[model samples]
Target: MGQFLQSFIFVLIVIILGCSKHATAAQFKGYEVKSSSTAEFNESVVRFIESQKEFLILFSKHSAFYRFPKKQSIDIQIRDFLEARSKTAVKVRVKYNPMTAEIQKIEDLKN
Candidate 1:
């Protein structure tokens, strides 16, 4: 009887863990892009964006990439990628600063 009860309790715990709410909720991620080291930051940002399936958020108001000489090329690439993804059923939000966290501009690709 003792062994059977232990087995049942272990199975119940497993079921609860497997059906966690976070498993279905959208995940949130953040990245910091600085003007002095945009190369690495750009690469990381691209990877992060690509891996996302449902949502994306960016926080970088003073990014140097905007001031770079090759800003046009880099900007177009990122913009094009986001535009393509935005055509799908994904949600995207970007913030230039943390002060306006509640005022996220949501981009619904389904539209």
Candidate 2:
């Protein structure tokens, strides 16, 4: 009886592990962005926005504004462009980061 119980427990553990792996596989399916500097981030953002099919997500850090004093105007232009582009069913999501002063990541989610 003890041996049977141990086998059942092992099978249960294996099943749980398999389910967890599948869940994580579905969550981490986004493309990994590699941009360190603000310039790199801006370039990536433009490219991503131009090529995005479904959604474009950009993170604007506080430092980006400080680095480029004229960034506010550029940001406005970007938003206007995105808003225009989004008329064709594309979604634009811009998030602000107050804690940090650096761009974080650019995510292009295409469904």
Model 2 segments beyond 4 Å from truth? 29-111
> How many clashing residue pairs appear in each of the predictions shown?
1, 1
Local error of candidate 1 at 27, Å?
A: 10
Give lDDT per model, in order: 0.35, 0.37
Candidate 1 residue lDDT tens string, 1-111 = 999999999999998866553332223222333332222221112222332222243324332221111233233444444444434434444423233222122222232
Leading candidate by lDDT: 2
Residue 53, candidate 2: how far off, in angstroms?
Answer: 27
Clashes of 1: 1
Ten-residue stretch with the least lDDT total in model 1:
37-46
TM-scores of the candidates in the order shown: 0.27, 0.29
**lDDT of model 2, residue 106:** 27
